[model samples]
Target chain A: MAIKVAILGYGTVGEGVYKGIQNHQEQLIEKLGDAVEVAGILVRDPLKKRDVQPGTFITTRFEEILAIPGLHAVFEAIVGKEPGYTYLSQCIEKGCHVITANKVLFAKYGNELLKKSKQHGVHIGYEATTAGAVPIIRTLQELLKVNRVTRIQGILNGTSNFILTEMRANRLSFGEALKLAQDNGYAEANPENDVEGKDAACKLKILCQLAFGCTPDWEEVEVEGIAAITSGEVQKAEAEGFRYKHIADIRAEGGKLKASVKPIAVSSAHPLFSVEGVDNAITLETSLAGNLTLQGAGAGKFPTASAMLEDFSAILEKSLRTKIHLLSARVPV
Target chain B: MAIKVAILGYGTVGEGVYKGIQNHQEQLIEKLGDAVEVAGILVRDPLKKRDVQPGTFITTRFEEILAIPGLHAVFEAIVGKEPGYTYLSQCIEKGCHVITANKVLFAKYGNELLKKSKQHGVHIGYEATTAGAVPIIRTLQELLKVNRVTRIQGILNGTSNFILTEMRANRLSFGEALKLAQDNGYAEANPENDVEGKDAACKLKILCQLAFGCTPDWEEVEVEGIAAITSGEVQKAEAEGFRYKHIADIRAEGGKLKASVKPIAVSSAHPLFSVEGVDNAITLETSLAGNLTLQGAGAGKFPTASAMLEDFSAILEKSLRTKIHLLSARVPV
Candidate 1:
């Protein structure tokens, strides 16, 4: 039997997932021992000029795509809450696994989704939602099984990191770097989420939930973005043998977690000091394993798509026991 | 319901595994949804003064432990190949899963073990055999499922890295550094495997088998250890803003793999440049995910034991499908 999956949005990640599945069909089949077919693609505009695989149906109506028989997984790449959240919940309720790139929805309602998943016995894969290509979620889920976690910190946002990297490396001002990032498609026109640290804060909440098994309110996280950081400070930090990085940090002790996202100066000895450009790096401090660091592409189409595929493959093999990394009980502040 | 397991050879790793399992018993029980008990321990001296659980059984004979009922997994921590290999094979033949920290046995006979495991439908967990606490084996196994790995290079040996780090940071010669490493318990008295690069070569073979499903002869890999790295060269490289790192490299393209272990000069831009002390770091260049780097302690009693427990927890959940990351068929080389 072929594994049938649907893409919930026709955006960059959705298109990338479609293309990746199409391109690596044979290799995926070889590894999975079965053909994985894209059944339908849910789009707001069905007439949008897009490259799609043959026999793949495109529809604007969620009901049309959900009506497909034997849909094993739904790839949720749509933005914002509302319909994306509703579609994913319906998929899980119907016993279909969900793979998503929507960090905002996950950060907010992850705990609820996980409880629903546990009740329905379905997997929710959010690998693409956090660090794009970096498999930090899976790493934490697997390695932290036998180790006591102490601290989890990382450069989780690529847009903010990219802007900071441009400012420091090219001697550009924050505005100049922001402009460059926007021009290069690294930042959005309305880049409040990236500039004001909301993006990294959301990811930090997700990470803390996975690492410490505790959910933190996104509103309570002390967040400071890159917009307030000056090039002089960046240069001064560099001259003082330190690098300024936008970091999402969470420290856990006695089952309590404190989370923050801010522009932090780090010495050369720090792992996050070297993470630049659109790169993401996470350092995990554990009692047994010592300090472990994982670095990779923080965000992009292909990388995010590849992450989704990993989750898809794991779900297919019936190996993904942890349904939602971020979906657990919220710790009362 | 309870999952039962055993430990072979009550040495550093074996003892560490015991303590780790005992300390994380509650967490393991929660994760596995069942009580995981260490049923018996195989040792040369059962009466040796060691800290263990009150009800834990210890015996000097492997057959004694093997005769225990409901043994789900056996952890192999004994050094060398002979009786360890035979015991592991017998365990697999009897349909019990095996987890090992024996790198030599893995590099030498991984192919045969994998074939036997497949024939008997048993899992062979060797995450502890390479880069002890870093979880590189699991990372490669999970991440490479969706990405095409091109090149993998790393500082795989803790002793070599410790020596090189000491040689640079303290301006010590290779002999002085080796003495320091031994004094710190970082290197064994017979450090030939680490100092001659054979240990790294073995690890590289294991990594290659996991990454490319192919294994090159361990002896065939170009081996050059830090024994020849003088403090003069180290200072010279440092003065020129480069670091000399002993790297185990494997490149796969067009379904052919080339493996080598050598001391390479790396600039600050290189991910392996700042990896110091007993730390091990690996940089993987893939087709879709870009450059991914993972760093941590490559060897230690507690770290390697934690890796073993990870396998134990996975086996308890019956989620470990591909057990032997490196134990696979040899391609037509």
Candidate 2:
């Protein structure tokens, strides 16, 4: 049986997923025991004539993709909340499994979609929404099954991390670093989400939900980006045998969840201190497992798509099973 | 429904598994939706009174444990091969799921046991075999499904890592560090496996089996211990702003497998440079996900048992499923 899935956007991640599946077709089939095809792709401009496999369905209409016969899953790679939220909600309502890379949608509406997916008896995998393909989210889900996590701290924003690395290594000012990051396609034109710490907060919220089963009001978490940091501070920290890192720190202390994203001074002994460039790393302090840290690319086309493909494999395995169980209220299960 | 399991040893890892399961009984039930019990424990000296819950079964004979009616799973925490391998083989032959913390047995006979378990339609979880409680094996299984991992480098042996860290931080000689480690119970009296790099080789081979589906012959992989590393070399490396780390490296190049365990000098820019003491870390460089690193307490009573508990939960979930599929030739699925 050939598994059929749809792509909601033909952007970087969407293209990457398509190409990754094509590249690893043999490996995927070997693991899945069946072929998988991207049945339809919902792009903003279907007539744009992008490179796609022959007979690949491309449409601008969500209804057309939804109407595609035997579409078992939907991949949401579009950004922001409005259309993505509407599209994913409708997909879940239609009992379609979903894999998403939209962090904003997840941070704002994850709880709702998680419940909705459970209610509809479908899976929702958002592994790409947080730390690209680090598998932090899945690991957290595994840990939460048998252990209590005390704290989770990470470098969740790649743009900010890249800018920080540039500022430290090249002695560039914040503006210069931001401009360089933008030129390298690592940051957006406005870059508010990445630079103002909103991006990290979104990822942190998603991680908190997985690790602690608690999600903070996005607006309530304290967030301070690398905007206020100076090259002098970076140099001074280096001289003092410390490194300046933009860290997203969340801890459960006295039964309270406290989260903050800010530029913090970390010593040489700190794990996050060495994670430079567009990389992200997460440290999980748990009761039984002790402290476990996972580091990888925080965001990228290939990495994000790799994460989506992981979700696709999981969904395929579940669907192939003779029976499926809604084990918990959680959607990913 | 209730799940019945047995423990094959009453050592540190065995005791930790027993207590951890007892401690997290509610959590386990919530995740599994069924009560799971350690129905019997097979120890060498059952008459030597030890701390145990009231009504817990203790026996010196393996036959007694195997005879316990409806024993669904067996946990092998006993050291080395022989009886452990025989017990596991018998357990699988009897269609019982098995979870093992025995790395030597896994490194020696993992392929045989994996095939046997799959043929018998049972699971064999050895999460506690390599890199205790870090979830590396599970994460690798997840990654192998979607990504092409090119390289794996790890700090796998905690005793050697502890010695190296002590030699650097406390300026201790190799012998002094070994004595301190033995005094602190970090190293066994005959610490040849850990200090001679054989333990790490075993772990590396297991990881290779999971990550690459290629198990190198245990003796074929190059082995280099930290015994040859002196305090002078550690100081020189530190002076040059580098750290001497015992790294277990395995890479698939040109369609061939190359593996070695050696003490390597890593610059501060490297992720492994910051991993000190008994903490172990593995970095997987993949085609899609870039470099993914996982760091944690590699070996500890609680951590090893926590890894076992993870396997326990997985087996419970698998057993609860209505149908089981030997999806891949791989048994871990």
Candidate 3:
């Protein structure tokens, strides 16, 4: 039987998820041992033109998608905490697995959703929650099993990093860099979230949960944006043998999980210093493995969708019986 | 009932695995829902003075370790192909999950062992067979499900990278840098495998299997050692705005897998250029996620052990029941 799934929201991530499944359907089926069919997509307007398959069901109501017979999972890409949280909660309650790239919603309700998903006997995959396409989430899940995370420093926001790179590379002013980033489709219309470090902090929050298994007080987490970093400062830092990188630093101090997102001058010896453009890099200090760094695209249609699909593949792997079973199970027991 | 496991070979990786399990006992148990105990150690000399726990069993015979009742898994840290392959084969036939860091053995007999292990109803984990502690294997397993990898470039050998970095940074000759690397415990006494790029090629061969799902013929792989690199060339490359790095370049051409490990002059803008010292990095060009680079300690006692342990943890997670049982299973069936 086909593994029925749905897409929640019709934005970039949602569309990428759709295309990824459609394009990689054969590979997915080969790995999953079953065909995955997108039963429906929950979007704001069903009438709005989208790059969707003709046979795909598009609707504004979450209930309509939820009512799809034998729906196995939902990929939530909705913008906010509201409908995403409610829809995912309902999906879990109805016994459907969920995967999301929404850091804001996940950062706020991750612990609760994780608990709820556990309660419902379904998996909640948030690989797209941080460092898109870097594979940090699954890496952390594996490493943190037997290792204690000492420190996590991340360049989580691609927009901020892109702006900072432009400012330093071309001597562009903050306004010019931000405008260029927006023109390049790297930044959103209201750039406060990207420029003000909220996006990085949200990603950092999600990371802290996976790495340290501790959630910090949302209000206590210090956040500072890259908008204050001027061209003169960028040049001065360059002259002083450093680059201004917007870093989300999370570490445990005296048994308390503390996090801060701010612009920091990084030297050439540092890992994040080389992570240029819209690339996101995370340097993790671990108990067993020592220092490790992962760098990749932080945001994009295909990148973010790749993470969600990874989660989907993981879910499928867990649900499916071991493929090597013929050799093992053939021996009469 | 504790999860019973064994360590074959008392080398750096084996000793590290032993100590890692002992140190992270609580964390492992918490995550796995059961305690894990090292049942035996397969070593050449049981009388050898090692940092082994007092009650742990030490034996030179693989059969002795295999005889331990209820042995769930065996960590094969043994070097070379003979005993490692033969012993792992026996372990699999007996229904014991095997995790190994032996790239040479895995590169040679991995397909056979994997096939045999599946037939015997066990898992063969070789996370440490490639880039140690970089989490590339699991990451590729997730990403490769729905993505086609175009190219894989890696600084796979840390000793070669360290030698190159020393040659450039201190203006040392290849001989001097290799000596320095050996002194710093980065290069082995036989440095042939490391400096000659065999180690990196061995690792690259393994990575090719995971990323492209095809094994290249050994003779067809173009292998080049870093020993011929002169300090003058290194300095000249530096002057020309590039740094020479030992890279394992693997790509699919016309549906055939080709791999080469050689030192190439990489610019500052490149991901592998910034990777220095006893660190390994891999840049994978994915059809969906674009280019993603992962860098970490490729070889070390703790680092390599961490990879094996991560594989062990993954095995345990698959074997054990889900933790959130009350939430899902409590409903009326």
Q: Is candidate 2 or candidate 3 better by DockQ?
A: 3
DockQ of 2: 0.44
Docking quality category of candidate 2 according to DockQ thresholds: acceptable
**Alpha-carbon local distance difference test for all models:** 0.85, 0.87, 0.87
lDDT at A230 for candidate 1? 91
Give a tens-digit lDDT track for model 3, residues A1-333. 998999998789899999999888888888887788999999887788887777788888888999999998999998989978999999999999999998989999999999999898898989898898878898787545777788999999999999999999899999999999999999999999999999998899888888877778879877999988889999999999999999999998899888889999989988788888999999999888888898888999999998899889888777654324332344443
Question: What are the per-residue Cα lDDT tens digits for candidate 1 across A279-325?
Answer: 88899988788888999888888889988998888777653223221
Give the winner by TM-score. 3
The model with the greatest lDDT is 3
Flag regions of model 2 displaced more than 4 Å.
A47-49, A217-219, A323-333, B217-219, B323-333
Q: In model 3, how large is the Cα lDDT of residue B152?
A: 93
Q: Order candidates by TM-score, high to low.
A: 3, 2, 1
Q: Which pairs clash in the backbone of model 3?
A: A327-B119
- Tens digits of per-residue lDDT for model 3, B238-293: 99989999999988889887778888998988879889888988899987788889
- When summed lDDT is taken over every stretch of 10 residues in candidate 2 chain A, the lowest stretch is A324-333
C-alpha DockQ of every model: 0.38, 0.44, 0.46
- Model 2 lDDT, residue B19, Cα: 87
